[model samples]
Target chain A: MYRMASIIKTESLVKDFDGLRAVDNLNLEVEERTIFGFLGPNGAGKTTTINILCTLLRPTSGRAFINGYDCVKDAHRVRSSIGIVFQDTTLDKDLTAYENLLFHAYLYGLKREESKKRIEELLQFMDLYDRKDEPVKRFSGGMKRRLEVARGLMHYPKVLFLDEPTLGLDPQSRAGLWEHIVRLPESHNVTVFMTTHYMDEAEVCNRMAIIDHGRIIAEGTPEELKRMVGGDVVYLRAKDNKMAKEILKERIIADIEERNGEIFVHGVKGDVCIPEIIRILGEQVLSVRLQRPTLNDVFLKLTGRQIREGSPEDEFKESIRSYRRRFDRT
Target chain B: MIELKVVYVIVMRELIKFFREKSKLVSTMARPLIWLFFVGMGMSRLVPQDITGTDYMRFLFPGIIGMTILFSAIFSSISIIWDKEFGFLKEILVAPVSRFSIVLGKALSGTLLSSLQAMLIMIVSPLIGIYPEMGQIAGSVLVIIVLSFCISALGIIIASFYESLESFSMIMNFIVMPMFFLSGAMYPLKKLPLVLKYAATLNPLTYGIDGLRHILIPHGMLDFPFYLDIFVLLSTSAVFLFLSTYVFERGK
Candidate 1:
């Protein structure tokens, strides 16, 4: 296999806010023409990392580069080679969809005729050409998201950065947006570096990094990351759970844990073990389930916590984190 | 050259938004006229003519032009607050264009809109029986442009510190009011208290209105030399523009 050069690289990037470290000595590399997902929970420094890469925020120490241009020193060149769809709606609500894209074209120094052609092509591609002349305020959340994605491609950038592209979108819209995003590398010949917390969304990436507390805990393809969970999970509910555990323990050498009345058997071939376990423990088996490891399970195995279950304490921490960011900026 | 184009597009977006909002256009145009007729007529009756050296309405005419530019120019930066609130500012900020271009583009648009309002007020000068000569009108245009740019830059400087429209309204009540009242737009600086006269001298609009008086009301009592007015307005606008650009770039 031919190796591809990194289009995005960061060398021990560190960003501190008033003595609180947001990103701590992070190193990341994303190859050209690949969809690289940065996966993390809220307050994981995802936005800060993307901001640094897009030249919106300067790193406190170390360096980052996009398309070979230093994010800090050669910010202008880096900006020119990249496009960004921020987590929020960055479109001018008062302007028409066409006008918004045109403004971007002019900012990027596209010629008048070329910009018009590109805007039309992008509007059509995003399925927004029919409503191109309408003000963006009239657009649905899904439509606005699509227009934003279209706007990000207006300059034919070498790399596109999406910070939570499907955040706050309905499941249908999320799927719809992903369809468009998945086709981007082939159609636009651009690398994608996106930050998403959704496990399902991260699965779509060609490669991904799972970050926590500003550090990447794991980085690999979806299959590789899942394989780290050891093996398929088998959940067995028997009439006598203690006897079942004893019997299963004698036959199979694997980690067995009980949670909420179900015996979870880990690191086993589910198909091979389920039949024997059922046959041996015949009438004692009440219910049995075989499951493959998902990205969520992998996160749970690595971090000992579910990714999506944000307790009240986590919400409080997130709010305080955001307040600190705002205070620091001011 | 690309930076210039970046500036141009930013200005264009503002102009397009300004023209689209008909109510805003009508209200901005109407505000000066209301003060010109209602407040000018009411105050003319209370003040004696010898103090102003002309009919009080004629004296208020130049002041009204100052008022128009002051309000229009400062409030134009509300577009910045609007952009911030709606997240559109991130689009411009993330672009490859220089921050100076962004500040210049905003200031130029504010200058254009405020100057347009100032000219519209000048057209209504006939209603007050004061017709500025063609030369006077031409000179006032230069003063108006300079003053508008100065005040708009001031607004952008304030805007850089804020992110919400509610904070902007607080600014309107605090900063905008004080600047307008002290600008000598409604009264002669010579007649003001000693401390206020000093405060008025520090105001760019005072120099601006004074410059307009030199051209629009040649016989009207002038506090400072016309050259000083021009000098102060030019230097202050340059300072304001630089400061605003600095504040924007420092955020990174």
Candidate 2:
């Protein structure tokens, strides 16, 4: 978040893939030199919104501009001003990592000398210089992702679009990638527009928009979004939740969600209310817990459902991913 | 409106990939060679000599070249499917290059690649007691280039709708085999029944094979003039180039 003006702006953007409205009338503004995150679950129109901004897909109606160029009418100029790392692996598996960057550079018409210089710098920046000449098929998932990010920056575009860059990465790989991604604003001085289903990934962004069913449900800095949930989450198992929830609502003065004989209270300052809740419920409470608001909780509060299928279910996908990895390797 | 530099970049990228798959180059020629040597020798003894005014292998050489280019064009178009599945097509769409530039670049590269394979098959011409004049070889290459351009565009346009290699090849087999067979690659169109002759004439490949016959045969074996081959192949290529570009620009 530098003191730069908006580089990406959309007004009433809509996209209908056949009869399905993948993107509703979306309005968004992203400043230059900042990492903006589109946070959502699967099929939440994150990729659709990115496609519109990148000028890869024409919107059914409305308008989008990147770096002052209209996405539709100024498609060529808009493309010149932005680079993208597709969610799917787009590199030539048969070609070396260096060759992939080479083709990308030439496609943008970078001068030979300048292309060489930039490719080296980016490969080194991504810590992939040693493996530059090796075919991408042999690279690990993390290395391939790093190469994709580097490819997206070859043109030195004003904005870089990454659609789920770290989707199936291991935790360590994800952290390693974010170190490079989170540094782009300061190092490359480029605006980054990215989409992700991972909560912690969204928390790394300077600003975020939570989209669901082709519409933005919430948008702000991470802290602001968490604050929108109104306060801390306090859940308690009581000997009598029916009695305790009613009593806590009268005494504690906070919003309470009663589910399956458990009392989950919202908007209460945990330290202040925990003591009061303990004293009031005294012997009737089976267990009490106070936790800070997480982005998952924020989504849960807004949509009344988890942002993803929860971390455990994601771990299942993660296992299936390793199976895919083995299959791809063989 | 097309940027030549972008076109060159795409063609260079495709060629580099083309060269890496040593197996692909070998295999493209192998199928046609098997037909030229084994099937042609076997069929030459059975078919009457006066019917062709030369051996069946000599008459079949040009048709084999046509088949080689046709099959090679279809195989070359498989790269487009990989381009889609691997998401390279998305990368190009998001780049500064024009869609028509991409379409022309791919079509031209495919033409060159298939022509190169067709040229390798040309090396075996003397085995059939036919010595190709340099002029004849150059003329045949030109015809192959245009036919490759025409067929590649058709394959690319068909491949555009398919995301998977299996489905694309499956659909291609159903279409490509009929296009080859109906082109009279294995028989003389002049001897076919009236309905079959009409169907053969409808195939753009019929003119290309006819062109190869005119160029490669010493005795005049052409049913149509040499220029008509160039005219039909070139015009068909122009039309497909336009259609494929339009379909690609629609961005699926």
Candidate 3:
């Protein structure tokens, strides 16, 4: 139902390193001029997929095409169509921001005059014009990241691949990055493909794929995925949850779960089911609440675990997960 | 995709980076200078003129020049690991340019840097009482380029597989040290054990040192035909260049 020209398409792509498969039978399509997110925790093959599409890493089997160019056979054409910002910051710390941009422009074979004009315009757009002459080593983490993203656009690539672009940045900086990300499609005709474990960050994507253990567990627009989790969450804090849950099970035609002394009634059969729930609970119902489903709930329903706490993962990753949890709730 | 402009742009980055690290440049120049002056002068009084023709310093001068180019070529390539550690390799790898061009640019810049350092040794050779003829000076430039290209190609090949500077540096020492010593840099490839002589011949730097020796001084090793030396050096350059390019293009 989501229709736009397909900019990226992969067919049963598999990537194996040694005895392990980093990506397994991945088949995905990214529409043109939209922000597509690969939402997953660390070591879930998010970065591997991006690397294959960018032609930086070869898939063990199957094929990936970017803008109609095969990643293996037509790698050169695929490369020309896309730009990338690595998960780690890659700016030359010794070089000034302007010099870094100039060097990138040269590597991309941009004409001198055109690069100069574009460099000025890009620096202004990134709000880095004032610090263009200063060495990047002196820049803040957010500033360095912003500069790296700006450099990725030097060649005017049709598709931009960002691998955990805002990883390790503070919440404000991450939010600020989204602002630039949001402006990209408005200012330039380019599609954005990105990876993030943060649900809040994935909120920016027009469509997203939830990946786990080297496989795509679910794929759809954010709204569509959330819809899969059921429309509304009906929460009721009862004086006696055990008794209230049992009564709701028989009298209320809705799926119910209890957490922290509150009962959540999911997939309510109808709006009429809410009044029936309260009336059946009677004096045992202390309080009740209703809310829409979120992306995290969609991930939970598909993967059988939270995005951040699935298994042994990077500890710093856990920090970002907690940050997103608290920040998004606010 | 292997555009000359792309190669030039990469070479400039190498030059800019090399110039900024004044301490490294000093040490790079100093390491071989110590061997040329202290070791050459020390050996001059010990070895008779027949063993090394005129002065031992002159015989050792060409060898040191070979050493300079070889080490400069290999060490300059260690920066590739540095680039990887700093995460710049991802940017270079993901660029629209071909990996062959990227490797070409890396090797080209290493060649340029190593050749320039070899020139510094060339200039300093005269100050150490081994004056090169005008013809030898002109011809040595070609030798430096060839030797640099060959050895730099070797470094790139090693660098393509390793991501850490420490591991690559250790491996470089293990490989390059033997290649330097066994190439007749500190000794002659004359009548000796049959095995040692064959090993020296097999070493690529032997031809490079032998070529510089024939040009810089009259006491040149004519063990092989002059064309053989040129052919071997050119072939080594070609093989290593092709190999390095292939490895780099296939790399993840």
Higher-ranked by lDDT: 1 or 2: 1
TM-score of chain B of 3: 0.93
Deviation in angstroms for B73 in model 2? 1.6
- Top model by DockQ, which number? 1
Question: DockQ scores for all the models shown?
Answer: 0.62, 0.40, 0.35
lDDT at B245, model 3: 81
- Quote the positional error of residue B178 for candidate 2 in Å: 1.5
Candidate lDDT scores, in order, read 0.88, 0.84, 0.80
Give the per-residue lDDT of model 3 (tens digit) for A1-330.
212368899889997755466678999998889999999878777777887888776788988888888888888788878888878787888888998999899888899999999999999999999999998999988898889878988889989988888889998988788899888976878899999988888887999999876789888888778778777878888888888888888876667888888898887633666788767767887787788777888878886777777465555444443432222111
- The root-mean-square deviation over C-alpha atoms between each candidate and the true structure, in angstroms, is 3.9, 6.6, 6.4
lDDT of 3 by residue, B52-89 (tens): 45567777887888888888888887678788778777
Model 3 clash pairs? Answer: none
Candidate 2 has what TM-score? Answer: 0.86
Candidate 1, CAPRI quality class derived from DockQ: medium
Local error of candidate 3 at residue A318 (angstroms): 14
Query: lDDT tens digits, residues B1-252, model 2?
Result: 788878898888878987888887787779999998899989988987754478688888888999999888877866787787677877787888878888888888888889888889889999887798989988888888889999999877887766666786577568788888888788888878999889888888999999988888857356677788789888988898899988777654
TM-score of each: 0.90, 0.86, 0.86
Q: For each model, chain A TM-score? A: 0.83, 0.78, 0.80
Which residue pairs show backbone clashes in model 1?
A: none
Q: How well is each residue in A188-260 modelled by candidate 1, as lDDT tens digits? A: 9999999998998999899999987778999999878988988888999999899889898888788998889
